[model samples]
Target: MEAKEKVYLAGGMESDWHEKLKQRFHNKFLFYNPKDHQLDASEQYTLWDLHHIKKSDIVFAYLEKDNPSGYGLTLEVGYAKALNKTIILVDEKSDTNNEFKARFAIVKNSASAVFDNLEEGIKFLERFSIYVG
Candidate 1:
């Protein structure tokens, strides 16, 4: 069997939605929630975020209304883009007006068909292997 891709989970740390992805992907994904390290110093938090993004091969972003302006999530998306890593965005509302949508390989509604039709998303990620090489 082929190795599962390394996926970085990016989203509003306070949202319960991220836990769903964590449970679903388990060992195949790395869940990065800065809120978990709220007690950590600012410098430590910054370093941890940078490290996680650097180590990830792909990013799965959850766009929740709780964080309409998710700075950390946006930063991770930009970093992943700079590293030429693949991105899959999950939003409850199917809005494609965002600039990041143009850059992502897949942008689907998280609440509905996105999870049901995950094969297309995974295949979109497979394309990254070519870039990884």
Candidate 2:
């Protein structure tokens, strides 16, 4: 059997978004949620997160435009870019027209694909991503 693709869910820890994805795609993909690996020290998490990022096949980053100051999300995107990994970015800063206005420059430039919201991005991934069915 082919090995399942590993995904690193990178985003704000303010909600259960990561859990929802894992629940939705648990059988199809293996996921690494940073919150599950938190340590007492910030530096420890940095190293741990990088290690997981290296191991993952795709970095599915869901960054809301209103919550744009994420150091970990930024670093993960840049590192994934350097490593030539697949990156699916959701930059959710939308207008009434549902046009995405918010973006992180580095993540946007590095992303293999970008969407205005998680649902849209998921649809793209399910349709086009090598690992996601």
Candidate 3:
């Protein structure tokens, strides 16, 4: 049997979006949610994130424009880029009519693919990987 591809869901844990995404992609890939772990310490969380980002095949980053200051997410994206992991960056605050506003520059540039929202990102993922179907 082939090994399942791993995708690390990164970004704000303010909502249940990560959990929902995991459920959505459960059958397609092995989804790792850092939020599920009991990472009470910032150091522990950072270490855990770094380890998984290195192991994952793809890093799916969801960054809302309103919540743009993700120190951890920024670092993870940079590391993933250096390690040659596929990065799917979703800019949740992007307006379809005005693309210039609310874009996360570093993450957007480092990403292998960028999307406006989670829904659009998921659609892109489906087409980009045969395993997603």
TM of each candidate vs. truth: 0.60, 0.85, 0.84
Q: List the residue pairs that clash in candidate 1.
A: none
Clashes of each: 0, 0, 0
- What digit string (tens of lDDT, one per residue) describes model 2 on residues 1-133? 5687889988888888888888877688888899898586988988988999999989999886666466678889999999999999987743322333344464688899988788998877565335444
Model 1 misplaced stretches (Cα beyond 4 Å): 27-39, 92-133
lDDT tens readout by residue for model 3, 1-133: 4566788988887888887776776677888789888788988988988999999998998876666466667788899999999999887654532444444475678999988888988887665457444
Of 1 and 3, the candidate ahead on lDDT is: 3
TM-score of 1: 0.60
Residue by residue across 61-96, what tens digits does model 1's lDDT show?
A: 666644555566667776777777666865532344
The per-prediction CA RMSD against the true structure, in angstroms, equals 7.0, 3.5, 3.1
